[model samples]
Target: MPSPVMPTSRRADGHTSPAAVSAAGLRKSYGDKTVLDGIDLHIPAGSVFALLGPNGAGKTTTVQILSTLITADGGQAQVAGHDLAADPQAVRAAIGVTGQFSAVDGLITGEENMLLMADLHHLTRAEGRRITTELLARFDLLDAAQKPASTYSGGMKRRLDIAMTLVGHPRIIFLDEPTTGLDPRSRHNMWQIIRELVTGGTTVFLTTQYLEEADQLADRIGVLNNGRIAAEGTAEELKRLIPGGHIRLRFTDPAAYRSAASALRETTRDDEALALHIPSDGSQRELRSLLDWLDAAGIEADELTVHTPDLDDVFFALTGPGNVPNQPKESAR
Candidate 1:
């Protein structure tokens, strides 16, 4: 077997590289409201880094600052290979953005829309047509190539928007809720495309409202609340930070339930459900301990299932009303 790889403490990538994005003590504000206060982020190359946050929590602001759409009030950031302030042009040239709104114009054909992007990128006419044709087939929009975007479904439009973003061949892409309204199948399709980009050695900085998207795609995820990172880690690492992650033991009979309940003293008993909620992380060590104890006590559970805390728990913990204003939310795309 390949050697078991260890994740960096603050990285989502199984293998680390010099950061693709790095910001330290970043700050931003709109009027009197401080949207960002001393925020810091380090996103490495060739990985999906998800920045999550509640509405009005500065996710857009952060993206804008990093992408050079807006200037920051304080702090410093680096994107791709250039510093944000000193080389905004270089950053722009190296990154592509698919923002919250569908950038695809409904008035134009899908092929035309892509051609427009290619033109904006300064490609020759023949080169523009080639990229447009390639992207149309790549995004599964070949049949709709000649049709106006207004005729496309929500998913189709999103895919086309992302396709247009790639016309420039950017090394880093920012997707701000790219899969906002797609159905399950469409969402998964977009996920596949994002994975393809990363597998081909691209860096993705994503923001969205769906926690499952982050879980499914992010190499690393950071919760941004009140303009600062409340917590950051891989999906498993973030889940491990929350409580109620455990192994559930279900008994077929009241007798078995009672016996198992007594045998596992630390487990919570639910008489009506005939189950024991053993408080533990579903780690191999914990599983072994539970089984060893059950063997020694001559008791058996009819069924056993492992449970882990989801992002919902992490979101509430870090960004609720009572939070210290540095929590992160889950935004997938």
Candidate 2:
């Protein structure tokens, strides 16, 4: 398998470069209720860092604060090498944002939306047209450049939304559920676009309700619960935090199954299926140990399979009781 892409630049000594976004003691509140309670983050440049949490868990609040849409009640933040509080303009210039809703102007042509974004960025008329054409073509909307955005499909409109965000060529992007309402095919396409952005040296800070989206895209993930980050790590590292991982051995011969069960004291047996479930983290050492034990007993059974807790399990364990945001109300169909 190809190795996963590393978003951050590393030094010769193996330490990471300076962070693209950093926050210390970030806090926010509305009226008597606190939304974020002193959270800190250090996201390296050129990496995809996903922040996950249930609805109303302050995920949106955190994004709003970081993106300069709202001020934090307490704490400090820097984005793309600019101090968020002191230089909001600089921060704005260095980052792009695609929120939960589409920003495209449905009444206007797709090309017009891109041009509007270019105009907002102050690109000259010729330059605006150049970049507009470029982005429209890049997003595969070249043929539909003159069509009203309202006429486009959900996926097409989303593609245009992101295309507009890129008009400024910001180094860092904040994607708030970019794939929330997209079809599987569209969502996959968005994933590819995100990967391409990171590959080209852009840093992405993503917030998503989809666990699989985070697993597939984020180099590192942070689980937010109760206004704080409950856990943070690579997908596999996070999976290791939860229990229920195991290796299962199945034997066709009842006698062989019983003999193996006798040798292994710790196992969950299924007599009907002649299978033994051994508790394991599914690590290499455990697999080798099981094989060694079986060889010593001169027992050759049938099949072996390993099972590990997926991100969905980890998300539930850390976030407590909450439904994963349902697929968008509208189907891809």
Candidate 3:
């Protein structure tokens, strides 16, 4: 518990927006095994920062430390402008955490669970009930408010979990694998909810096994590998880190294909299929240059498509083999 270090002046959007969460040289170890090794993070206020890592790569541990659930073995962190070690209570007051597992009380009703959170936040009876009713309606749990949480579907229970987290009106929320075990539709619904949260100026720290989830919702993504951040950037920026990006052109006529292939010197050719794969970053300038070359050569391709390295590629490349561990297979997409 040292004094929290001040965040660096670097801004995500090139403006002066304050950081909602900042950590420097954060380290954590379990006995002889080190989980996190001097990690640094700077998440801007009112944005979604998704941390992507293979199983057991210290993602949960990072969230736990940031949310004040556990102390970092070594580091300085500030959450919502409060020092993590020096002012955990103030940090807790400013943040809400929804872990990988649901916190819904099955024995109690959904409304009761919300009331319990409200009580924990020291809300007055009238205020607690008012917030409970509003949250139930907001999460589409009004009809099941009085029913035991055990009877609710996985998606409904997750919604309730998030709704309960909001009872304290926390400015920052840490969601660790919030959409696990949910159907595609339910996952999409959860995404919409997260989007709405950030739209209202809330800062979100998310960790998910689902690469698509990070790709879709995160304003910035950090890929952790071997107890360190391998890369950090926007989805497109991460994709650009890998070298497989290319533009494929296919021609139905062999003559046209040969002519195009001869014009394009740096291309992988598939003579049997009459296709050529030209290395590209999928940038507008490169695509336009390719198109202009085809037009000038008077060669028409039957099809054209761009292929870029996705998050999955970046994950596999950075983490390598064996580090992936036990993540659900479906989430790799």
Give the whole-model CA lDDT for all candidates, comma-separated: 0.86, 0.89, 0.90
Per-candidate TM-score against the hidden true structure: 0.90, 0.92, 0.93
Worst 10 residues of 1 by lDDT: 324-333
RMSD of each: 6.2, 6.4, 4.0
Model 3 misses residue 328 by how many Å?
20
**Candidate 1: residue pairs that collide:** 208-331, 223-328, 224-328
- Candidate 3's C-alpha runs over 4 A off are 1-9, 321-333
lDDT score of residue 31 within candidate 2: 97
Tell me which of candidates 2 and 3 scores higher on lDDT: 3
lDDT of 2 by residue, 36-84 (tens): 9999898998889999998999988998999999999999988887778
Candidate 1 positional error at 232, Å? 0.4
Model 2 — which ten-residue stretch has the worst lDDT? 324-333
- Rank order (by lDDT, best first): 3, 2, 1
Clashing pairs in 3: none
